[model samples]
Target chain A: MKQFQYVRPTEAGLAINALLKDSGAKFVAGGTNLLDLMKRGIEAPERLVDINRLPLKEITKNDQGFNIGALTLNSSLAEHKDIRKDLPLLSQALLAGASAQLRNMATVGGNLLQRTRCPYFYDTSMPCNKRLPGSGCGALKGFNRMHAIFGASEHCIAVNPSDMNVALSALDAIVQLSGPKGKRNIPIQDFHRLPGDRPELDSVIGKNELITGISIPTSALKHVHYLKIRDRSSYAFALVSVAAALDLEGTTIRWASLAMGGVAHKPWRLTEVETFLAGQQISAGLFQEAGTLAMRGAKAYEHNEFKLKLAPLSIGHALSIASGLVKA
Target chain B: MAKEKTSKASRRNFLKQSTLITVAAMAPPVALKAAEEQWDERLASAIENVPLNIEVNGSVHQAKIDPRVTLLDFLREHLQLTGTKKGCDYGQCGACTVHVDGQRINSCLSLAVMNDGRKVTTIEGLADGAELHPMQAAFIKHDGLQCGYCTPGQIMSAVACIREGHADSDEEIREFMSGNICRCGAYPNIVAAIREVKGGSKV
Candidate 1:
């Protein structure tokens, strides 16, 4: 940990002002990810404006749906009565992420603001555009197994490392952000950006802005499921994960939204597959076709060709579970 | 008239008492302001030999500390509470687990001022005076720890897990306890210890 000034502001307004004023200061909420980056010298700030005391820990129901405060811990949101009942996919996704203790301490705001968990990003010796703003990407040619297959630019190849974001995208969750510019609501899909020419722009958020809450519509998808594929059962990020929700009328699918993780720079929506699945009879072959369409635009590195294949399987499994083709 | 006069005196006394209570209630804020003034008087970014008024394990200590010091370091180095191990100080490991305000959290990840005015319960604070916490006793009986570096954190997490109702079975316990990495491979015994409390098994 580097030497820095610290302030514990009970008010969000004051915290934001402090963040905007300081030339090199960052907001600390939960301190799960940022603190780690700081310790490893990946993220350094001259000051830290702590916003943990702000009342951003509520899960309330509005006319639109559920509004979850940004400071709400991941474990609390995972076990929330509304999230568990109304958004089972989100609950399942949150459960699959990290360990119990981290989940207990990690906030929803921090999770949304989480950076890539690429081993290359963690090591400062390596070249990463997200870390260093393009000294050239080391993962492009070396240790590229876990790199993304979709939305990869020449500068960076790492994947978006959030399982919760995948589910939130599937449910069409909206992120509420606050800053010196006041407040704004962004759709979850548009919240995370792709690795375009500028891979450093991971999201449409400014440095001084803080995520205040997330809103998910109270939905009856008929069936919802979250599937995470990884080397281990727990304590590991997903290799290929899918969050799928489907509206089934008898044996045929009516409406569906599918989002895939660990395969793209952001949570990917398989809209082509969703369009194909609507009014089609659910079967293994149809599921395979949908999965195939989901990975149509994927560009794989030398080592991560397996992910291109594994990502489809991840989606197929999630589709089956979500459509009730198989028992949950 | 005498009774009315007595009543007036009693009301005056009650008002004075209320004023005193108000000041007492606002003491922490006032004390915090005074402390701030002292910090400003020194007028140095590098405040050598700064004192940290940390309340830990139901006690307070004004320990001299480096301005760059972490709460975990302050506990392990200043207070000699070695129960909080420093495994993967990057917050990857839960070896530095402690309770700040009745909830389990990673101490290494938090700064000392972040916890000021908040109650801290480290692994050393888990047990009553001379009496081991039920989780600690269960771990000892079940042989849940080997080498024991990660034991304190594991025990603290176990306490939280049970209280959070995550200790339903071995699988659940294993899932919930994934943060506390035990290199000694004492997982089976650790599960047994948690089950002894959650499943109500006789150890």
Candidate 2:
């Protein structure tokens, strides 16, 4: 880890000002991923504006639905009564992530902004376009079992390693930001970006911006499920994970929301599959078709060809669990 | 209240003035030119240490620490509280687990400066004078450790797991305690110990 200046500003405005004043400054909430990156020398920020002192740890509800402060710990959010009762999918997703200790330390906003778990990106010795732009992507041809299968460009093929973001995308969550310009809101689907030519840019957030909170709309899709398949049963990154939410009218599906993780740079929302499943009866055949439609444009790397097969199966399994066709 | 406010204001003023003088004295002409280009980097590298005040266990200590030093190093190296082991030094392994405000966290991934004015309970603070904590006693009774390298972290995480209500069943205990890795394969004994503690069997 490199030496840096630490500033703990009590107000979000002051924190933003500090970040804007220092070009190399970063806003650290939980320091779970940032400190890991720093230890690996993947990131070397000169100034860290600790945003933990800011008043952003509330979890409230209103007509718009739930408003979760950005600094709320993952453990608190996952175990919050309102979240567990109203949004069980998000709770399950949070629980399925890292571990209990990590969940205790990681904040909601920090989890949303976490970097990919690509081995190439962590190794400074390797040529990673995400870590160093213009440097070649080692995962493109090298060992890429964990690379993205969707929304991947020639420059980078890293996948977002967040289970919470997958559930947030399915729940139609909105991210609120505070910066020098003012406050703004971005839908959770648009919060994270695909690996384009500029793989260095992770999200749409400005350099000086600080995430204030996230808002999830009151949803009708009550039957929600988050299923993560990993190498190990726990404490490991997902090979392919799915978040499925369904609204049923009798035997037919009224509405559906679906997203997949560990398959794209961002949570890959299966909108086409959701559209196909609506107005359709819940059955094994329909679930199979939805899974097939979800993987239409997915392209796989050399070592990650198994993901092409595993992704659709996981999607079908998630849909089955969400529709109550199969017990989770 | 007036006295505290005045002292705080004076401290702030003193910090500002001293920082300016140090930057002026240490920064060379070439460094100042580079600082003009990238001020944040130059300004940060110019300073050597940052002020940190934290409460560990029951003791409060104020000191100047390198911003790069992790809480694990601050405990093991500076404070001489080596009970908190550093296994991976990254967030992957939970060998440096500690209780920050009664919640378990990995200290290796947390910077020492980030914990200013926060209460931290490491493995060294788990014992009650000469008496062992219930979890520690259970681990000993069940022979839960082999190499004993990962015991402190495992014990810390186990205590938190029970307190957080995630130790109701064997499977739940296994899932919740997944962060702490014991390479000696004493998992069965460890689970037995946690189950005993969860069942209120202190002996």
Candidate 3:
């Protein structure tokens, strides 16, 4: 790893200002992903403003719902009684990610900002537009088993590798940010950006801005499920995961929210499917239609053409389990 | 604290001088080597090292080091605690697992300077003087290792798994202890060891 200056700031403004002062500076919360990228020479920051000392590690409940600090470790949030009881889907997705040790070190905000697991991005020898803008996308013509199926452009085809983001999208969580200009809140669906011409920009977060916390509104959707299909049963990234939450009234669905992972540049929210499932009775035929609607415009590459079939099945499976119609 | 820092600084200086002298004595008669050393020293002096005071295995160590030095390297290279093995170093493998503030984390991914005032417990700290920890003894009794390369990480993770109450069953232990990968395929025995420790007593 390249040598760099390290600064631990106790105040959020100071950390933000330090990053603003140097264009090559970055904020290190958990260092789970940043350090790995640094060691591999994929990323080289001149200064690292350590934000671990900042006062941002809190998980509080309000009338609006829950406000989780950005520095809240993934393990703590997953095991919290309130989270497990109220938002089991989020807890399940968190547990399905990485492993015990990684969950201990990874922060909620860091998880939101984790880079794609595209092999082309990691291999500096290859040309990856996401890693180096205008360098060209190697995944488009090379091996791209894990490339995006939606919201992908000609510049890049990498998919976002985050289970937590998928669950957040289904839960309608809001991300709170603090910057030099003050504070703002962005809905979870808009937090991650699609890979367009500027593939280097992963999100709408501006320079000198820091994610302070996340706000999730109270929900009456008690039935929730996170189904992840991976290469292994444990400690592996998802091949195609589904986050499904439904509010059921007798045998009919009152409301529904669905999201997918390992298929797009961001969490693929199924608004059409959610609309189609609402006010409808739960049945195998209905779920099959919802699955078909969920994969309407999904385009798959050569190596990942199996996802075209696998994604719809995962959506149906997740909804069946979430609606209590079938056992997970 | 002041006296301890002073003494450590002096000892560091002595070691630096001795290493330099030994290297010079062993080198061949090459004038270009001396010029290269001067250039290296000039470049080294340009980079500032960050000061860190980390407590590991109940010992407080104060030193100035490169900011890129990870907690795993600091423990194994500087403190000579070789039990914490480095596997894959990218946080994919858990061979460098250690307890930071009573929580199991991958030390390889955590920078040493980030652990300024935190307590770190490595495999060396698990024993009570000469006696082995129950988890350690369990691994030995069950023959839970073949190459023994990932043993320290497995033991550390296993202790944490039981403490976190994730070792209630064989399936639960396997899922929670998935972080530590034993390339030699000692998982069944590793699970048995963890089950014995979990069934026997508190971790």
Candidate 4:
């Protein structure tokens, strides 16, 4: 790792100012991904502004909904009583990611800004547009079993490797950011961007901005499920994961929110399937239809054709589990 | 325009004379060679070190540390607490697991400067002076280790797993302890040890 200066700022304003003054400065909160990237020489920041001292580790509730501070550890958030009771999907998703040790060190903001687990991006020798702009994407033709199947441009095919983001997308979370200008709230769906021509930019956050907290409206959806399918039962990135939450009225689906991970540059929201499931009776045939509708525009690469089949099956399985038709 | 031109010419002349004077001052060949040989090392050591006041294993330590030094290295190298191992050096492996503020975390991913004024408990701190911790005793009783390379991390993570209430069942223990990889296939024994400890068996 390259030697760098470290600053611990107690105030959010000071952290923002430090980042604004130094273009090469990065905010280090729970340096799980950043340090790993630094060790690999994929990220070499000249300065790291430590935001752990900032007053942003609260998990509070207000009129809007539950407010989770950006610095809250993933382990704490997953085990929090209110979170487990109110938003079990988020807890399930958080526990399904990385491992017990990583969840303890990872922060909410860090998880939101984590880089892809693409092998090409990690290898400095390989050409990855996400790692270096204008560099050809090696995953497009190389071993791409984990590449994106949705919202992928020719320049990059890497998927966002965050399970928490998928649950946040389904729950309609709001990201609170503090920047040079002021505070702003960005909806979670718009927070992460697709890899168009600009594969380098991960989030819509500005260079000098720091994430303060995230808010999720108290969900009325009683049945929620996060199903992550990976090579191992744990300690691995998802091959295809589904976050399904449904509002049901007896045997009928009142509303639904669905998102797929490991298949898109961002969490792939199944809006069409969501719409199709609304006001419909819950049945095996209806779930099959919804799953087929969810895979309408999914395109697969050479090694990831299994995802095309696995994605729908996982979605169906998740829906089945959420609807209480099948036990998880 | 005329004043600017004269000023630019004088600045150039001053720069040339200063370069000549600097070279003349370094005319001693031996002195220049000595300075050149030690310049890189000197400058590297001169890089600012952050003041860290960390409490490790119930002992307070005050030291100046390089901001890039990880908590794992700070424990193993600086403090001579080699009981904590560094398997992958990345967060992928749990060999560098340690307790920060009573919560288990990957020390390899944590910077020494980040944990200033915080308490860290490594594998070295697990046992009492002459008595082994319950987890350690259980590991020995169950023969949980083969090569013993990943024992420190596994023990730390297992202690945390039980404390975090994720050791209620065999599957939960396995899932929660998935971060620590024992390549020697001591998993079944490790799980048995964890279960025995979780069951509150006296060693």
lDDT digits (tens) for residues A1-328 of candidate 2: 7556688899999999998776667888899999999988888776788899899999999988999999999999999999999999999999999989999989999999999999999999999999989899999999999989999999999999999999999999999999899999999999899888989988999878889999999989999899999999999999999999999998799999999999999999988889899999999889988888888988998999999999998999999999999998
Clashing pairs in 2: none
Output candidate 2 Cα RMSD: 6.9
Instruction: List each candidate's DockQ score.
Output: 0.26, 0.40, 0.41, 0.45
Global lDDT of model 1:
0.83
Please identify model 4 stretches exceeding 4 Å from their true place: B1-37
Model 1 chain B poorest 10 in a row by lDDT: B40-49
lDDT of each: 0.83, 0.90, 0.90, 0.90
Q: Model 4: what is its DockQ?
A: 0.45
True interface contacts reproduced by each model, as a fraction?
A: 0.63, 0.81, 0.84, 0.81
Error (Å) of candidate 1 at residue B139 is 1.5
Better of 1 and 3 by lDDT: 3
TM-score per model (chain B): 0.72, 0.78, 0.79, 0.82
Residue A240 local lDDT, model 2: 96
* Candidate 3 CA-lDDT value: 0.90
- On TM-score, the candidate that comes out on top is 4
